[model samples]
Target: MMEPAVCGEPTEPAAPPPLLAQLRAWLAAWLTDERTARELVDYGRVGHYTLALTRWVAIIGQLFTVLFVHFSIGIALPLVPLLAAIAASALVNLVLLWVLGWRARLSERAAAGMFVFDLAQLALLLGLTGGIQNPFVVLLLVPVGIAAGLLGRTFTATVTALGLLVASLLAADPLPLPWFTGGLVFPELYRFAAWAALSTAILLIAVYTYQFAEEARHRAEALAATRLALAREQELAALGGQAAAAAHMLGSPLGTIAVVAKELVNALPADHPLREEANEILDQVHRCREILKTLGPRRAGSEVDRLVRAPLSATLRDIADEFGRAGISTEVRVDSPDGTPEPCLALPPDIRHAIANLVDNAIQFATSRVDILVSSSHERLLVAIRDDGPGFSPDILDWIGEPYLSTRHDRGGLGLGIFIANTLLARTGGKLHFGNTGRGAEVRIEWPAGALERAVEEREHDGGHD
Candidate 1:
C-alpha cells in the first residue's frame, strides 16, 4: 500500500529552532524596530494620575524636611530653598490637574514637560539635602522612569540622560546626611555604586515594559479577529432556516401556477390568438416546475432543511468565483466514485463560510494561482486547498491553525484566520490539516458522508431556543 502523507515531509518546511533561539530572534527584531521597542499603552489619563501622585509626594516630603530642619540633625539643609522647591512643584501639579480635567488625552509634549519639571524639583531637593549620599536621592529617577515607559525612545533617552546629568552634578557638593547630631559622610565607592544602580534600573525597566506592552497589544488584536470570524459564522448559520423556508414555500405556489396555465391552454380555442399566449405561459410553468423538483420535499431529510443545501462542488465553485472577481486565479475540480450522485456534498451557511475563509486565505498567500479540490470515496468527503507561493515559515509551521500565531503581522493579520476557519469546520464534523509542499502551503479538510449535514441540523435545532 502507498504510505499516508506526513505533515512535514522532505518537501515540507523544516521544524522550528529551539525556544531560546526563537526568543532571541524575535527580541532582536523587536529592538531594532523603534516603534515596537517603545511601550504601547494609552497615556490618556496617566497625566492626571502622575500630577496627583506628585502632589501627595511633595506635601509629605516637605513636612518631613521641615521636621528634620527643626531638629538640626544632619548638616542643616537650606530649609528655605527646599520648602520653596516643594511649594513650586505642588502649585504646578495642582494647575496641571485642573487643566487635565477638561482634556480627553495628554499630548506627549505636555506630559514630557510635566515630567521634566518634576525631575527638576527632585534635583533641587537632592541638592539641598545630601545629593547622591542621601537615600532619598534615588527618588530623582521617578519621573524619568515613568516617562521611559510611556514615551518614545527619543523622549525616554533624553529624560534619562537629563536625570543622570542632574544626579552627577549634585554628587559634587551635596549637603551631609541628616542626623540628630553631626551629618554623616559617604565614601567615594558608595557614590559610584549609587550612580550605577540608578542608571541600570532606568534602562532595564524601559525595555521590560516595552516588550510586555507590545505583546499585550498583539494578543488583544488577535482575539478581536477571532471573535469577528466566529460572529460572521453564526450570522450565516442563522440565515439557513429562513432560506429553507422560502424555498419550501415557493414550491407550492409555483406548482399551482403551472396547473392554471395548463388548464387555460386546454380551454382556449386552437384558432384564437389567446391560445398561443396560454401555451407560452404553460411552457414557462413547466420550466419552473422542473427547477422546484430539484429542491426536493420540505420534510425529506435533515440535509434539505437548510437554505444553503447546495452540493459541495457547487458551493466550492461559487467561492472560487468570488475570489476570481478579486483578480485571483482559482481552479476548482471534483472527483466522485462511479455511480455516486452529484450534489453529494451538503453545505449549510456555516460550512459555506468556513470554506470561503480557507479559499480567501489561499488566495492571499498564493503567488499566482490557487487550486481547490473536492472528492468523495468510500463514504468520505474531502476538500484540499493549494497555493503556489512560498510555504509556511519553519518557525510557525507546527503552530498553523493556532490562534494568535500569525506570520503576516505586517499585513494586519491577527493570526486567528486559520484558527477560526478550523473551529467552524470542526463544528460540522470536519477536520482541517496543514502541510507545506516544496513550493507552497497546502490545507486539507475531511468529513464522513452525511456527517456534516447531520451536525448542521443539530446545531440549528439547538439554536432555536435562544
Candidate 2:
C-alpha cells in the first residue's frame, strides 16, 4: 500500500511536510511574494483604529495633565500644548474609524491600512508633546504590533525599520513643546536614547509574534483538507472491493438463470402465456449478463485505480443507451473530454447493469427526463444521476444501498443497482453518496483516477458510440 497523504506518500502531489519546517519555509516564501507584500499594506487600517482610540485617551490624559500641573506648585504652561495635541489627535481618530468600517471587506488590505493609520497616530502624538518625552508616546508600539499580527516576515521587518527610524528622529530633534525643560544636559539626552531603543524592540517583537500565529493557522487548515480526502479515498476502495467480489460470485447464478430460461422457452407450447413469461426471464438474465460484463476488471490501489478513466460523455451515453432500451428517456450533458491521458481498466458490464437499473427505477416515477451529469476535478471524477420523478421518502435512504431492497411494480427488479455501484466504489477506493437529503433524490459517485484502472483498460481509448 502507498503511504497516505498525511503520512507523505512518494506519489502524492501535495504531500504534507514536517509542520515546523514547512511553516518557516512558507513564511519565507510569503514575505518574498509581491502580492503578499501588498496585503501587508492593509495593516495600516489597524493604525487607523488605534488613532481613534488614542484620540480619546489623549483627551483624558490631557485633562489629568492639566489638573496635575494646576495643583502642583512648580508644574506650568505644559498643559496648553498637551490639550491642543489631544484635540488634534481626536479628529484624526474619528476619520480613521470611518476608513476602517468603510473598507472592512478589503480583507488583507484592511490589515495593512490599519497598520499605517496606527503609525501616523503615534507619530502625531509624539510630535504633540515634547517628542520622545511625551508620556503617552508609548503609543508608538501599537502600529508595529498591528503590522506583526497581519503581515509576513518581510513586511514585519519593514515595519520594525520604519518604527526605529521614526523614534530615532523624534528623540534627536525633540519637538519644541511647552513640556520640554528650558535646557537639557547629558542626563536627559541619555534618558531620551534609552526610550528610543526600548520602543524599537517592542515593535519588532510584536510583529514577529503575530506572524508565527498566522502561519500556524494555515498549517492546521491544510491538514484538515488532507484528512478529508484520505477518508473519502478509503471509502471508495472498500466499495470497489465488495462490488468485484459480488459480481464474480453472481456469474454462476446468472448463467443458471439464462440456461433455465432458454430451456423453458423451447418447451412452452406456441400460444402459452407461460412461454411469454420465460422469454421475459431470458431478457432479465441478459441484463444480469451486462452487469457482470461491467464488473469484470477490478484493480486494487493506485496502480489499478487509473484503469477505469472514461470520457465523461462516453460514460453518460453508455448509461443512457441501456436505460433507453428499457423504455426510459434519459438525457445526458457530457462536458467535452478532458485532454489528459487516460488510465486503463474498464468496469465490468454488470456495474453498468446496476447503474441502468437505477435509471430504470427513476423512469418508473419520472414524467419526462432523467438527467445524467458527469464532471471531473483534477484526479477525481464525479457522476451524478437525477430523476425528476416523485422523490424517495427519507425513510428509504437507509435501505437504498442494501443489495436486495426492491419495491417495484414489475417483479423483475432486485433493487441491487445502488448496491453494486456502492460495492464497486469500495473496491476502487472511490465513493457513492446520496444527494438532496431533503425532497429530490440524487446519487453521486466520486472516484479517483487511480481507482478507475480497475474498471477500465486504458485512458486514451475512443469510447464506443452511444
Residue ranges of candidate 1 with Cα displaced over 4 Å: 1-75, 107-117, 137-185, 228-307, 310-314, 325-328, 332-355, 372-384, 395-406, 409-436, 442-454, 463-466
> Candidates' lDDT values, in order?
0.69, 0.59
Give per-residue lDDT, candidate 1, residue 316: 85
Best by lDDT: 1
lDDT of 1 by residue, 295-409 (tens): 4334425433444466777888888887664556888888886645545434556567778888888888888888888777768778889998777888877878876677678
The candidate that achieves the highest TM-score relative to the unseen native structure: 1
Clashes of each: 3, 79
lDDT of 1: 0.69
Residue 406 of candidate 1: its Cα lDDT?
A: 76
For model 2, how does the per-residue alpha-carbon lDDT over 1-466 read when each residue is reduced to its tens digit? 8645554445646667888667655543443344634543333333323434544665676567666755663544555555665565566555444434323223344445445655665676566556776556666676676567666666566776777777776677675544335523235666577676666566657756675655454445444444554556557655655676787799998888899999999999989989999999999889887766555443233333444545555765776775563445777764426654433234545455445656666666565667787665557776677877567656776667654455553656555455655665565566777655243567777788656654443321212111
Regions more than 4 Å wrong, model 2: 1-74, 77-85, 96-103, 134-136, 175-192, 199-203, 231-466
State the RMSD for candidate 1: 18.2
